[model samples]
Target: MKLLRRRGAVSLDDRLAALEEAADLADGRLEAAAVAGARAVVSRAGARRSLSVDHTVAALAGATGSGKSSLFNLLSGTALATVGVTRPTTSTAQAALWEGAGSGPLLDWLEIPNRHEVDGTAGGGPEGAEGMAGLVLLDLPDHDSIELAHRLEVDRLARLVDLLVWVLDPQKYADAAVHDRYLAPLARHRDVTVVVLNQIDRLSPEAAERCLADLRRLLDADGLTGVPVLGVSARTGAGVAELRALLESRVADRRSWADRLAADAGAAADLLARASAGAGAGDSGDRAGAPRAAEPVKAPETSADALAGPLTSALSQAAGVPLVVAAVAKAHRHRSVAATGWPVTRWIRRFRPDPLRRLRLGAASAPEGDAVGRTSIPAATTVQRSQTDTAVRDAAAAASAGLPEPWAAAVRHAARSRADELEDGLDRAVATTSLGASRRPVWWRVAGAAQWLVLAATAAGALWLLGLFAMDYLRLPEPPVPTAGEAPWPTVLLLGGVLTGIVLALLSRAVAWLGGRRRARKAARALRASVEQVARALVLEPVTEELSRHRRFTEAVSEARDEVRPGRG
Candidate 1:
């Protein structure tokens, strides 16, 4: 029954502000039907507040022949509403203002053209308006009237009035139409509702008490257990003074308007909470699934982290990071062979293509004058695309696991907001990554230099031997040669030079192979880092922002729910 029973130190403005914030935050994240009541409350409260807090508008409503109009005349001390000549006598609402002159604009807003000025003397009420100065009492048309428009009039005024007096006859007080259609729904408005048993003068005291008891039972079943119920006879003036006193007190307090409005806001806020909170609560539960006003809801698993892992994997394949890493390794080995190969065959290695350059992953692969551009990596295929979409939707589902359908849908949309840019972004990331393949290792250069020097020595030794042969054959002088032991210097140089070059080349090849693999692993790591950045921009960040909104929305709803609710007794 806390349908907006606002109780606490919170001011009216603060409560309304919290409600407004919730409604605004809920716009796209909650269903329209769920938040519609909230919007209406805000509007109605604003209008009612701007007009008057000094006045109280109370409505006397009941089925035809219940003497509701007679009671209205008895309390207000005027015959503003017609009394019992025919059924459906009051076709429209009639207002009786205790502070008559100043309430025209308010009555106009209420659309009650037939307003009477009550001097408080006509019905044996207090002699002046001082007893109920700011009361605007309405005698609404008969709710049970066969005339459709008369019934419609009663229903219309019922919602607008600050206080409700459900006048019932002894015979029909327990009727289902009255109990089911009006009292049951207004159970939450108990503090501002009153039930009067009219025509009780016909019953003896014992009979009247019994009727009152039976009526209370009916009201309790209608969920209006604590609502005020009294016996009054408009024809005999029995208990009319008591009814007048009740009305006067409510008007003097001048809180019924605010209380009524607060009740509305609470009901609307309750609905909003349920809609935002996920579904699955049953009938005895809040049908829309109530959101708790407790501590903020936490992510069991962070959505961004959850989304990034699979997205990064998908993007890596899409961007050709694997291809680039492979090229880095092959290119490193290719360069390695050139750097450490036999001098005679080193030139042959140049004819083979540089794997990194062919894939455009190397600096040399950057076009002669263009930007580090798109890679030669294949586009993401249908299979990869499907996997990526699945990952995003799954992440959304997890992030919004317990949320209502509307909020979950919002999270999904946020996840996919930038999905279309994934492929291009990942490709750019791959292209600009420094795979470290183009740069040569320091050892390669040193080994290459050593190979050339040995080749030079080998040529010199061959030339020295040729010179001796020529000298012996054509009468030329021979130069002296040095040796380590018995071997001539020329022979030693030739054998040592050829042998050293081959051995050095073999040793360098081993080092270069290990270095190439290491560099390839390093390149793979770098490319992955780039892919992660792309995944974050294209996928994870949007999810994070969506979650942020969700947190704020929940917090706002909680504030409305937990803070001092205004408008309760």
Candidate 2:
């Protein structure tokens, strides 16, 4: 109980729910048999819970000549089952219900047609029959009978019973067939099981004690340490009273079926855990198998953060981010030359194509929010495609490292599920990114306006000189030709304006070059960011989701298999 409270009071139903969830999440990633067994546990528990909540079903199971039928008749106070000593007696299961109320459905669920109803004061029965009003005792065929049908009947009923009373004789208590085929496989059901050394009257007291001690040793080795063991003689009515008290106590608890179902679910969950972490796929989950070194199943060491850097870098190269960045720098310079160059020489740079526009990734290509634009960037080359595949595979392998084979395969598959979309996604990301070239700088405008002013001054001075020449030729006096020192005003204006415009154009070009380099770096950062998004959506996210599923599945399995240690008997 302390363990239960410490673990947050996880009930048996919660454990079953956890196991069912794990089974759902790991349908194909776990062993087929193991998964099927878990489903069976859940289905059987639901059926049992719905059938008869008030009754406890305990089946008497033993090998041939173990006097199983005699004991069944003795406890039931009637010759309901035929008894035989040297041969098999009960070839089919027989049930004896107390009062027989609302038990038809329960019997039908157990598939038992031969049944009897016993009253509290009917015959010379075991005492306290009134207290066992909810008990349902079953007599099963010999598990070691020569007839295959009889053995099969015993095996089937044994699994469905709420409690099992295993009847062993002093002669064959250590029988290999019974121990290997039954007790060993049912080690997890210790809480819902009891052992009876039948036919003890035939042996001396010392011999019976020795056999009992030996049987306990065997039971403990089979992982049934806390289960009760009793020595009884049906013919002499030796320990039958004690067995009856056990039945009354179990029925009084009114939760034997619940305990049995919990054990079943726990066993099934353990099977799945072993299947997931076995030495190999399809390894046997049998508890009685030879001992081997235990293996701990740990979570994978890799995560998305560890894989994203290399993956995004490789994908960026594949998406042509470097080429696009270079084009952005050149396109900036080209546009800047037209906007800031001297008015007289601006046309010289017009013939060169805008690098960004040629790739359909210019500032004009990027659209408004949430809209993707098309691009004419060349398709990936063979080398680029190969590099992308290698990087993606490496990422998948690293993400799934240390997982079981099926889970690892699942992670790898998820990593590449979006491979067909990577090309288009990367292109859309590149074309839609804001690549720092949509508007010209304020400096470019100021330089261009200044250049135009200087050019206008130069043009006016030329016209003034032409007029002075014309006036002299026509014998008219020139209008007050002003001079600055040794040079005339028009001559000085013409030389200074032309030289100033040339110098301003050179200065503007130099500034644009430096600005273009800076813009290239910024554009590179933006383009890589876009490509990184593509990488996550296409590959990294899927891998991370799959790993999360694996973790959930394993955690559920652990919880489902965590049985309470104190009351396990």
Candidate 3:
């Protein structure tokens, strides 16, 4: 009998734990109303516990002419509640207290100003039924009452009551106002809810059975699949014992309040789960061997690998890396030509500005400020800027695609959060990267020494030729000039020096061309590497962080929905 009569299968501790878990699940995903409602459930549960677990508050509620007050009186075995055919007879809530057991604070919170005491020993309710001594049965005003205050009173008591006995008549059993507005909202409370077909005496047994079956169908459609429904006549006492026994069972159990609260939490949690189910849909696959819900939600998956390449390319272009590379090659060629070319023509190379120095870039002896300073690199053209914008948004979109609402937006924001910093970051990267153009190569110095030696030889040879001409003009004796092959000594010296200097200059120019190209390629690679780093730090980091946050939110909501296993609790 004890097992059969227990109102809830779960202990109070278990139910409370489930409620807390559900509240945790609803932290960020649910609507404001749902979060507030869950908090209210927890708050009310705590308040109810602090007041009295010994007292069970049950309310009998119905339409204006449903005989709910009469049923309440019958259950209490006293005419504690007003009963009449007048519309909205009970404007305020009335309570029938039993066994002189006090529930003052609980009733006050319930706002039941009218109270009546019942003789616990009268009517021989049942032997060994002393456990129901703390029952407070309330007869509430009609939910469909003409008076707005009466309906408001019903709403208030219905939310607070530990148990609810909904009284209905054959005539109004299918009332849309009652079913839609009242019963449907309490679908979560089916375990603590009872549906009574009152005024059964007015119908034949077959008609009453048919009405009860129809009500059961309606309850099922309302998500109250397992709720109990009974047919009773308050005047004939038919099925009244069953209703009273059901109430007594609930009132006897101290866990009924916890069960009611659990139902409320579960309902709130379920609604929140539905709200967020579509969120993070394309996130990632399930965690590696991690336990999940029986039917787990699909998580969102995003990869920054694909985004990295395009992002780096865009940044490289925007930072003028190509122009820098070209400058590096040209600078190398300019310096080489100045060092190894024929000394006389080398001055011509000097007049051409060093390409790197012109751009304020890669000068070995430049000031510290020059190395860290912004370059004369041209601003990115409109096409380049558009490409960069498209790259950033595309990366964000790809990573956030199919993610649930809010989290998807969050990821996108994280990706673009640092967009304003991109141009400056890329510029800084370009400025700081070592483009290898600053260092003068050892070969350039050796070649410069060779060029000076050749120029000196050419100078001495020209002087000898001029001295030969001057001696012939003045009829002076000429110094001995050694002849080679068919050419005169002075003429050979003059022509050979000129031809050798010109040949060395042409060879140096050819070497500079090859070395310049190689230098350009090396510098471009180094600069682009720097650009990639900036992209990762400025763009990828934020998006990854947002995705990580989305993952945590998903786990929290999943745990809240599936962790406790409400049925076990």
Candidate 4:
């Protein structure tokens, strides 16, 4: 059992390693799903210990009246189990332990209580009888029984046993069920199974020999050509000693367990190979058409370029400036608004229209009462914005359509299911990539608020100063005038506030610009990573898996060739 466990662990480790490597090379949901499937296979394989010594059980399965129980008794050298004259004698399983050196622990694990001590001191029946160790023989219910439970027991134990010694009587040696269901299904396990024409005492020597040959032919038809078929009779003890020697050889070498595990591993590898074959063709095309190739084709001012002229034109119109004058007008507006000037006049300028707003760009119409006293933008701007959105959507759809059927369906499902996440990723990527960090910072809002407050204060101070100067210059009634010095105090406060606000706003803009630059760099890196991930999953990973499958298939074909070659040894 421990040896079996170790072998299972090794197989599981190899499978897990392969899966991890594949996962690293893959991408997206396919990578995740493949990794999950591989892990499941590994876990199941780990749970199954192939041909363990603790389970060194061999089922004595045969047709009714085949003397299967008598043979089982002969092998164990004990009549501990009942042998009935009825056709379907053994209705349930009865295990017998062959007590030899190192057989105690194995038998205990197999839970077989009936034991027989085959002594070299008294036994003259077979030479080399001492070699048979750790063999637990099970007397299974008759295979040809009408009772469903008997057949079920045989079928169940057949799968769990390390070896199977199928017993057939002369009367029913060619039973269809025995050959088709039992023999054919286990053709792959030929090394660990044997067939015996039991109760051969009823047939003549010539008839027995011919029956054995026919059985071998049947086995060959079932794809078990190399498996041994022997004629044996429990009553005469004919060929029982030779069968015992074969069993002894199996116990001595412990090669059956290795052979069984190898067969199972080969089967699992075949499954993986088939899956790889199915995925191979799709991988080739996807690799050749990766998304990053679009970048060079869409480069600035190139024939393939579609963004520069349209984007610039759209932004110019949106900013309410003529396409040629938008850049210059934007600079002038910034200088005029930000420059320090006489406190009273600057306060009055706060009520004037922003130059950008005055250019009348943006949506077709500005909001009624919420406007900055600007006219509506031109109709062409709205049309251009709509066109840009449509173009982007159409391009995305076309790209999605070009994917393979299943993959395209999967992409569509993902897009629909995770639209919000995709949108967020796109927005973040665009903003960070296109806008430098220095131009957009959180502190800008605070700075803008402070600048407006200062502007209001300056305006109020200028109004007070003007009233005081007017009263003195025109000799008008000084109605409720506080003092002449009060005007200077307001002017000083206004000037100080304006200066501080201007400095803070300039600092905020600088910080915003720096932040935007950093964000843009980060966005570029993320986009590249995303593109690479898609390329690997859609192209490289599938191709590698397919190639691996093809190589394994070639190796299997080569092995089959070696197995079939005449006198290859």
Query: Model 1, 1-569: lDDT tens per residue?
Result: 11233455445665677778878877877767756667777888888877867889999998888998888887777767787758877788888888666677778888898888887565455554677788888888889888998887777778778999999998898897887778876755777999999999999999999999999888776667788889999999898778888888898887898778766666566667666654321111321122221233434547566667777787677677777777887788888888888897788999999897787668744554566667777777888778777877777777777655666688789888987787778777788777777677788888889898999999899999888888888887767878779999899888999999889988987887788789889998988888889877767777777777777776665555544335543
Q: Which residue runs of candidate 4 sit more than 4 Å off their true CA positions?
A: 1-56, 85-87, 100-128, 268-420, 436-569
Whose lDDT is greatest here? 2
Clashing residue pairs in candidate 2 are: none
List model 4 lDDT by residue over 1-569, tens digit each.
Answer: 33322321343234334443433322342334433444443443344443244335567898877788889877876675567777668877877554455556544544445556655432234444455555667888888888998898787667556678998888888888787667765655778888988888888899888999998888877767788888888999999888887787776776565455444343333333323333431122122112211110111111112322343333323322343133223423343334333233446656766433443322223244443332343333566546534433332243334333333343334323432332233222222222121232344445556666777777777777787788889998766644336555666755766676667555655654454344445534443444333323433333334334333433432232122234332
Window of ten residues with lowest summed lDDT in model 4 = 292-301
TM-score for all models, in order of appearance: 0.84, 0.90, 0.75, 0.51
User: Which number leads on TM-score?
Assistant: 2
Clashing pairs for model 1 are: 6-565, 6-566, 6-568, 278-404
Tens-digit lDDT string for candidate 3 (224-317): 7788899999999899878877877887766677667666655545544444554232222222122221232444566667778898999899
Candidate lDDT (C-alpha), each = 0.77, 0.83, 0.75, 0.52
Task: Provide the RMSD of all predictions against the true structure, rounded to 1 decimal.
Answer: 4.8, 3.7, 7.2, 14.5
- Ordered by lDDT, highest first, the candidates read 2, 1, 3, 4
Which wins on lDDT, candidate 2 or candidate 3? 2
True lDDT of residue 234, candidate 2: 94
Q: How much lDDT does candidate 4 score?
A: 0.52
